[model samples]
Target: MTEQPVPAPGMFTLVLHTHLPWLAHHGRWPVGEEWLYQSWAAAYLPLLRVLQTLAAEDRSHLVTLGMTPVVTAQLDDPYCLTGMHHWLANWELRGREAATRRSGADTGYTEPEALRAFGIREQAEARLALEDFEVSWRHGASPLLRGLIDTETIELLGGPLSHPFQPLLNPRLREFALREGLADAHARFAHTPRGIWAPECAYAPGMENGYAAAGVTHFMVDGPSLHGDTSLGRPVSGTDVIAFGRDLRVSYRVWSPKSGYPGHAAYRDFHTYDHVTGLKPARVTGRNVPSQDKAPYDPERADQAIDAHVADFVEVVRRRLVSESERIGRPAHVVAAFDTELFGHWWYEGPVWLERVLRALPEAGVPVGTLSDAIDGGFIGAPVDLPPSSWGSGKDWQVWSGDRVADLVALNTEVVDTALATVDKALAQAAVGSAWSPRDAVADQILRETLLTVSSDWPFMVSKDTAAEYARYRAHLHAHATREIADALAAGRREHAERLADGWNRADGLFGALDARRFPR
Candidate 1:
């Protein structure tokens, strides 16, 4: 038999950033912890299945997985673990109840039978999710992810605790956060990350120095952040720490946050839900069609669409890699990064599509690997001085510090000042300690609240008009917590500050290695 030559000479790296702001003890129903539980069940669990299957096949370096410390803290917290188990059990109950639910006669343009069918499907899905959670994630996410890292199935990327928008963060606090975040990863997985997802892929002109200081070898930014030439990872600010840009042309071909393959007419409609069963029954019939008039979702039809998309995406990557290699005079590199939650949480069929694409890419002569492989394989380019940018709108910092979230911007500034000053004062009054040693309780708690307040999610949510009210409330809540503790410490009310710290620790505490002295002198 004649041997077929390889189809392309390039590399494909898929990076999935898994993050959700710390939401363990927050609100439950409409948002907050609900988001955490849903994403865990829908996206994280299914995502683990996909990667786990590949791992079973002895696949190594399948993708790059970014796990933020803040999110990690929540996933491993005792409270969150208990809550997740309960949530999963309750989901099974809800599904069981819904399976026999009757649709209201006034159920706007949908048929009653479709709603019942969705309920039946949800019952089965919920049961499987619960079983998976029990068998795998019952302890925490650390063990599952640790196994992946140990087996080389995925390369882990660590980021700043709380996912603060580094460009907007104070340098001292930013440095402290990054160090603490890396330390957190080391504690959980026993591996120090050489790369980070860089919180929204946000970068500043001099931020590479921070990456260098924290021992980060590489991080990701948007394509435009690298001026649209993303064929290679470029060294930034003359530092050994490299910056890889997400290839948007190849990435957007799969999906973006608001659109892409997920918007196909044959796929499950994310926004259209059956209120009676708390299940999505509709397909994305048409862009102009109202939710009430949408057609029922069909798994078989979605699978067909997924197969078509998998083939198209593989072809697109093949062409891009060949053209880029020819243009750059080297075997070109492409990286497609997305939110891990986008898979099963936002797009119901996303996991299926992911598994399909990952398997198909290799068969199509595209070598799928992680970012670490790209760098080690010598995909380095010339140094580029990256401007202050993010993967957000305008490929700049607008989504975080723009006018829409101006109030949050101000709140963060004030909170940081108060927390930093209070910590400095506390340290001056007390005995000096090493960076790793835990300082005063009040100071540490204040820092914790301060870090949570500055998380990039708040401002991003506000700017995007997604859970805006909740974002505002959380920013103010964390800010207020910082001020309350800081004021108590300032007045020499040591007892009051300690008590406040104790009370707040029930909700805000995560990083046990967090020391107040590390923030300043």
Candidate 2:
């Protein structure tokens, strides 16, 4: 008898999560609308282009893309579109300024050739980004994303509105947020996502039931959440909802605490900036090197690094797939997850690396697919009980609920409790009286502010110490808005409540179609 052939290696899933706090009409410089526009120009636009190109070539379902409802709202907002256009135009102007200053004596450039090349490259990129924005992104990103989904080029994963740490949210609010978030995605894309990115990949026991009730078939979690056995997607306890654990061995190859491809000496340094033009001009010369001592960026050098890194990552995935499959005595699945913004925004060359990897994986006999496809392809594992966990530090809920952010946790509890109570009372009164409608604007705004206050960004920022003050201020501001509106509504001051709602609506307005009636009474 002929010897039986060994089965092929297991499949790979790349999960890229895209999210940002509601930034429209927020501050512009350093960390607000600027953050949104920068990421849009540098990351979202390029990634979309790559995926669309692949779709044109009949290569579909390249990766699983998660876009949160809050970020989607901002992307589709008219105000943000106009602002992004203006931001792009200004970027081109800055590029021109850099080019003109290249010949100046006080520019502090030891290499004139590199300076000139940087200027020309910056100008070209800015012009191209502007053109792309005008032609494709002028109306909104929803249509572009919808087309990709329609073509099956990606499996979209929707998440909660405002990206709250679900494990910490009140159960009623958690369900309300998840339902509303999915509804919002359907409204925009005409598709209901079966998978959720589960804000921060955070999970708690029993949350699977919530996901099941909300129609989510699968969600992602950290590898440790599965007892370090991330070779297969497992069902949560007895729930039918599946949880795919991120394979950190593969993911950390690209990014981790101690090392990552982004930290290579040839890659553009994210920290150092050219004060004159607000552009990054240096390469990461060394980990310990000061910004002033860093060498100028060389595109050729970065391209070589990208090629090497891409090859390295492909080999890593291939090895892991073969090893895990043999160990499990069956075909195993490897899921590598990442923050979408890390591509063009943080690492600059990340988009190029991604494009190459997507193409190279298939050539190496490693099948790449989305999490949904993995399950449909028969990679399910035994059920396991997941502990309270997140993709944050320590692989626990500490980043959002730790001692450093205890005040934020307390603030969120107080705000959510107050908002829910006020809204419930108003809904009851409306049912009893014929004059009031179920959809009260005051109550709606209150819930909106409450959701904003509970965003996991506040605590993450506080713990990480990056823009902590702004994060705290934003949380408190929304909480204050919720409280003031609730108080006005309680006092029978309809006019005052309307005024307060109108003001906060203009400032913190997102999810324009949200109706407070969706909340559980």
Candidate 3:
């Protein structure tokens, strides 16, 4: 058989999104705040530290962090900041208690030796805070993100205030959300974002105009969204917006929902629990085993798997880059995008796998660059309009507003509209530059309420059934804030608006520069 020659030369781009919804003022004990804290510590903080370290070494990460407005708001929020400090302290206490349990000889497990070993390991892990808490979370806005952006180590991309699945939203609402989100990004991050990450990677037929109006030039879509056979960015039907499709072949090599690398037997079991102590204690068993019965993680075995996967992924990327660049006689870009949480939140060894991949890519001579660089270079051409689609189930919006989440979407729409209207009236009556105007105070509070209300986390929490109570509480808190601000404005109680705005700002410390002019002219 005649051998097929190599294809065109191309590049590889990696985009990682970092976001988490408002968890402060909601849940903090046992389940609620713990989830938030762990993610902050495990994935977000560590990821940032790693990136920063890379930057110091003059290593170009070629990564983008999509700080959704809602997430940024929460991160910058004073309430969240204070809450996180307390949460970190509580974690340290937990670690201490775990250490005591390990040493006191009071753990009455049937297998004392095994129980002792587990306790000791757990205690050690708990006490180790990776980086100092203050240094990890630091001031308002993720310290890591703020540092990276300020240093130009990463190109920051912004998203809607609450990451609302815009494609399904009313066009006006979508426009409003995008406008507010981008403006908020500029105010908080102190940089204008050139690109955006459509919440859930969701796009609709005419959403490009919404993006364009908001000043976003590019976004990402699923591989299947491009008819399952392409990897280039293309235009929607009638706009200049560029929609970059994921290279599923390469992406699936790392994550593919059911068939992804996370399902590997050597990986930690994400859903197993200890029958004795009620904590997650099982290891990753065979791939086909029920999650409840997987074996404990074997670091040795997991390391082996990581090495194999990294090698396989490098080859996949290398061949694709070389052949694509050769095939089209122009450098082609193969973008592999994935959720940031998948690295450590869902896949236990994901962080390790990631480190391996990052280190291995350069060694393999496969040049890695950010999506923006690819666009800046000749790898991608003129912008194209994208069709309505998401990287969700069936490459649509089922996961976000599916049968189970549809009701939540309706509720979100009404609440967001109600909040926006209240803010509009307040802005009208307030002095634009006055720090103490009643109307302006109300306007800002209303904006805060709008943000907390639109957090996509609420619907996601309810849909996932992880922490429904916390979700419900947060949604209601925003609703209440919105209603109270509106009532104050209607009654011409500028005093009340001023007072509430102060308190709300203290509580909702996000979007420090939320200007009301972003609304329609």
Candidate 4:
């Protein structure tokens, strides 16, 4: 195996991106609930629990977590909180069923011939903590998480609401997304963020000005964005916004495009479900599965694989740190960043790997530190203007606003612009008024409608081809609100505006204190 570089004694940066799209007041049950519950149970809770445990042990793992305003709105929304309550109860029911089947309870839901199938599904649900889903989401936006932020256990990063792939978006509207996003973060967390995840680690050459305007000093980019040719901590546009490029060489050691440790032969296959039922039941030893066949999952084999991979990764990071420190005469921090969902939500054993890795890092003499620490400790080098790129294919916007969703870009552009103009007009008018009339409420709804309408999820869903129908429906719903508010004002229907505002408030209540002035004129 090729040797990895080692950083000096005190240089390592770890960024964990925490993001979930707005699923509030959108829908419940079936696929929508699945998206929320699965993530909540598998990734968010386990990750937080792990962090809390570490913190309790007085282990301060310096990490960066990005919770977009859109995700925060959903996490704190009353509707979502209620839906999560029901969803958790149902999830526990699923776990009970799985447990009963595994115990051969003769619950009238099992067959002797399919004992193996029942066993696998039971194991899957149990590992998922399906029974704890309610408690998980309930405790997900944990006081402990807030503690981490307040105590500086981790550096909190911010991002655009709904994570619009900004480089491909219109300039003025992208500016709106960035500014409002930062303001929303400030309102929610009561602290301004020093950095951002840059929405998919996507950056365009001139995007630094927007970051500067929003008071963000640092943002991330894919390593390849720097032509796969330079070190981290480069400056962009002669501004204070520092562009930190991901070290793909080190990152891919843990997560690769095609053949990461997650895809090891002994690991559980993400695809290949059993034919008898929809349960996954196998491991892939190689890229050697038929186009259409169910594979059996092996937990015992997967556990062994996790151990091996964790050991190798820890050593790799250690070696990298040591070698780099030796070369530079200073500790060289190796930043390993990945989607937080990778742990358990997508890669089934991801959470386990994380626990092991976190524990191993300290034992192996490689400390985990946040990006802010790296910047503050003078580990930073000269900054450079990041090229327009993303963590998407070729680090481009193709994954988000690609040919498949070609029309959404222009449609969203017009709607967002019109909505912004409406807000500007309303706020300007309301400012000069003597009293808060009923029209103010109508104007408030218009602002809410505009933000929700401008969510980047619609175009993203269309591009990804997942839940495209629901995406279109949501886009239209918000668009309708924006249009109706315009019509209500144009017709001078004072009573109509009040009625519509009341109805809109009832239907889409959220962050009612938003100020439309955050958007650039």
Give per-residue lDDT, candidate 2, residue 11: 91
TM-scores vs. true structure, each candidate = 0.96, 0.97, 0.84, 0.85
Candidate 3: minimum summed lDDT over ten consecutive residues — where?
Answer: 103-112
Best-to-worst order by lDDT is 2, 1, 4, 3
Give lDDT tens digits, candidate 3, residues 1-521.
86643333566777778777755555566565566666765676556656777778777745777777766766666666777677656655554444344332322223333334544565565455434556555676555576687776677878877677776665655677777778778777668788888787887777777777677887877877776534466756667667777888888888876687877777767776443342333456776677534555566788898899999988899888776666666677888888888877777677777767877787667767766776677565544545567776667666677777676677677766776676666555564677555425566667667657766677777777877777767777887777777777778886886787777766665666555555552
Residue range 197-285, candidate 4, lDDT tens digits: 88778777778988887788888888788666333476687997777777777788878777688778777666654333333445665
As for candidate 1, its clashing pairs are none
**TM-score comparison, 2 vs 4, better candidate:** 2
Per-residue lDDT of candidate 2, residues 60-84 (tens digit): 8799999999888888899899899
Evaluate all candidate structures by whole-model CA lDDT and list the values in order: 0.88, 0.90, 0.68, 0.69
lDDT of 4 at 193: 84
* Superior candidate under TM-score, 3 versus 4: 4
Q: RMSD to native for every prediction?
A: 1.9, 2.8, 4.7, 4.5
Using lDDT as the measure, the top candidate is: 2
Encode model 1's per-residue lDDT on 1-521: one tens digit a residue: 86754868879999999999988788997988989989988898899889999999998899899999988888888889888889888877777765676663554436667666766888898889888878888778899999999999999999999999998899999999999999999999999999999999998889999889889999999999888999999999888989999999999987876668989999988887666556677899999999888998788888899999999999999999999999999999999889998899988899998898888888878998899998899999999899888999889999998889888889999989888888887887676464344457888899999999999999889898989899889989999899998999889898999999899988887897898777756
Q: Where does candidate 2 stray beyond 4 Å? A: 1-8, 102-113, 433-438
Instruction: Tell me the TM-score of model 4.
Output: 0.85
- Native-to-model Cα distance after best TM-score fit, residue 252 in candidate 4, in Å: 2.2
